[model samples]
Target: MPRRHVKLHARPPQEVQGEAVDVLVRRGLDDLRRELDVPPSFPPDVLAEAADVVRRGPSGSRVDATDVPFVTIDPEGSKDLDQAVHIGRLGDGFRVQYAIADVAAWVQAGGAIDDEARRRVETLYAPDGRTPLHPPSLSEGAASLLPDQVAPALLWTIDLDAAGAPVQVGVHRASVRSRSQLTYTGAQAAIDDGSAGETLQLLREVGLLRQAAERARGGITLPTPEQVVEQGADGVWTLGSRATLPVEEWNAQISLLTGMCAARLMLDGKVGILRTLPDADPRDVQRLRLSAHALGVPWPDGATPGDVIRDLDAANPRHAALLTDATSLLRGAAYVAFDGELPAFTMHAAIAAPYAHTTAPLRRLVDRFVGETCLALSAGTPVPDWVRDALPELPGLMSAGDKHAAELERGCLDLVEAALLTGREGQVFEGAIVDVRADRDEGVVQLRDPAVRGRIEGAGLPLGEDVRVRVVEASVPQRTVRFALADDQADSASA
Candidate 1:
């Protein structure tokens, strides 16, 4: 899986340049987008339809609920807002009202915009820009959950009991206005300083309760810190990393709560799609235990992988190695659609629940269909035939989009790593072996200073141990970086 990085790799020219080497980085990313067959622009007909829809305005059937003091949270500078939330405390419980962008409201079932979105599958992100599933006129404009905009949305009111488990759930179309838009950093700062409003404070209380509940339920969330590739004020590309903020997880819980509810609704209605991952193989689990023991991380008796992972800090070298290795179990995620028959495998290994993607309809294609399906299920209305028709094709489309996104992202990151190391061939750097292949002759070495990971060549490279490695190769065009044990050269000379 390609890790999600905070990329400054948006549109080129004056913005991306940090100097001369930055030019190479920019070119490499462009090559990657082309290689992935990413569509550069929306079709003319689709653009026209999106513009027409924007002019016509949102659905008139939406109920008035703009008085709800909703707020949006996301990365800084994000414009394609999808979900807005308002949380208030109930008697010994919490009430969460989440408003999801009603993409289906603006997109007619068989229109050109719909057909184009189907062909595109989902949004694709790169360092330069995003290939949006819907044009900006809709995704970032009319259909967005921008603050104070009074947009049409599918409003979900979920009431959770004292233990953070859902006690009641209902969803309907409504006209919503977000009171404010906040970034994770901004929200966390407010809460930490004790200056947050009722919603932010309640978010902290409810989020902690939900996190505790997740741990209690053996849910797995491998929040492996992202390798951030950024450009400094000097226009120089720099590589660093940061862990997911506490607020991010809490906000994500709200989305996950809605998705779980959506999955429940579809399951009861016997017609919907799901985001599923099979349980990890027992042998892999046992192997991970051995890895943990080798890395000096103690695994308590009868502790689930999620339990151990929850306590392991990604900042620690030993813990990071284990987290890197544990990613193997998170593979095989897929989309499953059903009309009458329920799929046996519905649990998302990470979420540890029957989950669906219902919150991010702007960026993800399936969430629109899911939101529509769940709405019909909640309203006791028939599932739209168009949604039913799109279900089977969704898996392939999403899978392809996921593949392209992962490939493009990984390629871009690799290019940066290679370019950053290009002039330092043969230089020794301190790094820890975070992962080793089954053969034990090669492994992944994460550098301490630059925060880059690359293949290390050697026999029996010690996992989790700090070692010095000499860069053997850095190819910008190839998007590769390879290192060899510094001792390899010493051993040869001594012999």
Candidate 2:
């Protein structure tokens, strides 16, 4: 397997996340993976089939779209490319040509590769490495929408009016060649310095327009920075956060538009799975407002949670805490499959619209299926029997995969915290209470110096206030790092 290098997002960087740099940290990661039953490599048969599929190449008459000059944008050194884009003028509207990697071209359904992908469900990432959904030969090579590589793709032609509202959308299989692969910082620099081509300049225009449309629809987009651990030249590991550049968010708008478009197609057919999240419970939003009030964070009257959160800065400790805890509002996300009758609910609250996961097929299992559903529905053909039969179970597999991925992320973070705080037990640290559980004498804390977040055991824990606490326990072997209120301050905390 090719070495996996993935940047992972965690709690807005108010936590300790490990990227193995030393022998001890590396061994601890290995042990942690074993405890979680994470697969280290693909099966022999799966790899053999992947290589054979790549050798045979795409096996259909694909629409030649290489002249469109699409380009891919992702993190630096990224290989598992998934989506590419090119924007052009279309009278009073814009023509957005987005090409997503067509993984179905190489990964035969029910074959060894597909079966293995089903088990994996989605790509699992850590600060150190990742467990990819497909073998690298497909994910990073042939099926990846890499620059200068003519690969099969699901090309989407979405026409958007001047206001960024979609007027028409269509997707079909095609052969595409990305003209360039750009990193976020590089792309943003080009746009800022007036060195960008028409495609990139149009992306900025379309991205801003779409953002306004999202706000009008009461949507919230959380562009969380990734947590990273770097080893210095002297071999000392230090952890930090990678603040996302503007280009990343702009690039993401295109994906979001495509997802919303795909969902429209699936909903029209009424026979596909949707990535759904009902509107946030009103009680949850009220709770957030109360917390913000206690923390002295301003909440203007008539402003929604999305508005308040949009104005927050992660660099502020109080804002960081609020943002971390605010994730609760976006909970209860799950997949819903419908046949003839539409489900009772279908809105993805955060997006404020019907949405499906239709991009990143190389990394996510559901996207491939969603792509197929939209393709068949668009072509006015019968949905494949295999696809129809699998819809019922896809939700369960994806839900399980979501839970497992969360566990893996938390375990890795705990290991890093435990290792970083070795020999620091019984020491007091300054931190802030991010969340308070009314039913229990405990909440969540974000430490000051190391920026670690963990469970806190204390009474009268004020929400979003800085306080001093002692590290009651830090056990590397158990992969645990815990904190408790100091003896003198146990009952003294106030809102």
Candidate 3:
């Protein structure tokens, strides 16, 4: 029996590069667009109702947004402000505060807002625009953490020790006001120099401490460069790798702290969604070990999976990139909403603990449910039945949402990469081999460039990071890019 062709190998400049490739990749995205069922519009009434809720202060909870000096950091043109943060140095460590938008206040159970939110499940972002789960009036306006507006929020106050590990975590819901809205680029520039404002400086401190703690814990980190497609002067798509600022990762660390804390409480109580991934399979582990050996990366015999990944990441970046594929293989992320018994698997390989999504309620529905559960549990009240009942269905809904998100993103990426390379099909760009598998028919290759990442064809090659390849063929219709060995360069290929 013939094995399924997995990789589309790279080639020399002369064999495959020209106008023919662009036509192929374009057709592929079109097929994805039809298959994915991307939405065209949401009901108008839903948006209007969300706006009403945001404008009207919650009658059940007391909130005062002033005095915290909360500031929001997000991409340019972003309207849904899901979180706000402020940090300050305490006696020997730091006091970090993350204020997440209290979306529950507006989304009352069985209400129109709730119905619409549940129907959409999650926000869908496309190259053209986004289909927001909530109406713009809410997600972009009233519910948004705009500067000087007193909005309801679920605040987490985490006290970090000298090493940046959380010594204490406190959660509560209240009203808060934002000092300003900042962008990653602006904060990054400030951190690079001494000119950082008080807000930016505090953020940098928080980011640094959290990063140090992760490194100390032997957390596996990767440099997953992503392409940001921007429309040019004539409305043509252009692609560039989005810079991952220190502030971005630091912000994520803060969210991790919050989510980990939430997961701990839920697990202790013996119920709730435990975001988990099982340990990597030994087969893939052995393959990675072999790749590590080839790349001069030493794997300590008894090191934890996280530690092994960390060492590999430090030694060879391309091999580290490949580790990402295996990381997800531990287990698919599940919402395990059990009643009394805690499931056997409760560990999140990345965080080294049980974790769940409790942040970013504006964009993700699961977080909203988890946030409500945490709020109720913290207050020593019975977890509401509606939220609990919804738990059973959450896993399926979230899985569907995840699949849609992945397909939509890949579809958009297909368009952007094709458009960027349409004019220069044969042009060679630097890329690292992400994966290489040769079972029977054709050797497969997955390559990563600074601007884009995709699979190609090739085999019997050094599969590790930093191996350079020339872009041999780019087919817009097929949504594929082909690459081949160039100038005797060794490539790191991941499975």
Question: Which candidate has the top score in lDDT?
Answer: 1
lDDT of 2 by residue, 183-256 (tens): 88789899999999998999999988888888889998654444565544544544555566667677888999
- Compared with the true structure, all predictions reach lDDT values of 0.86, 0.83, 0.69
Per-residue lDDT of model 3, residues 1-495, tens digit only: 011112222322221245333333344545666778765666676766665676675546655647888888888878899999888888888888888887887788888888877777889876657878777776887777888888888888888887777788767788889988888778777777888777578666766777666766656565444556555344444455553666787778878888888897787766677677656577867776676676666678877556665434312355544564445445655667765788877887666667899888889888888887887777778788888888888888888888888878887886656545555555566655555565632233433433556555566555555656666666566666666665455243333
Sorted on lDDT, best first, the list reads 1, 2, 3
TM for candidate 2 is: 0.91
* TM-score of each predicted structure versus truth: 0.94, 0.91, 0.83
lDDT tens per residue, model 1, 312-385: 77667788899998997888999999998998777888788899999999998999999999999999999989
Runs of candidate 1 exceeding 4 Å displacement: 1-19, 438-440, 488-495
Worst 10 residues of 1 by lDDT: 8-17
The better candidate by lDDT, 1 or 3, is 1
Instruction: State how far residue 203 of model 1 sits from its true place (Å).
Output: 0.9
Error of 2 at 253 (Å): 1.1
What TM-score does model 3 achieve against the real structure? 0.83
Question: Candidate 2 has which clashing residue pairs, if any?
Answer: none
- In candidate 2, position 222 carries an lDDT of 56
Q: Give the range of the ten consecutive residues with the poorest summed lDDT in model 3.
A: 1-10
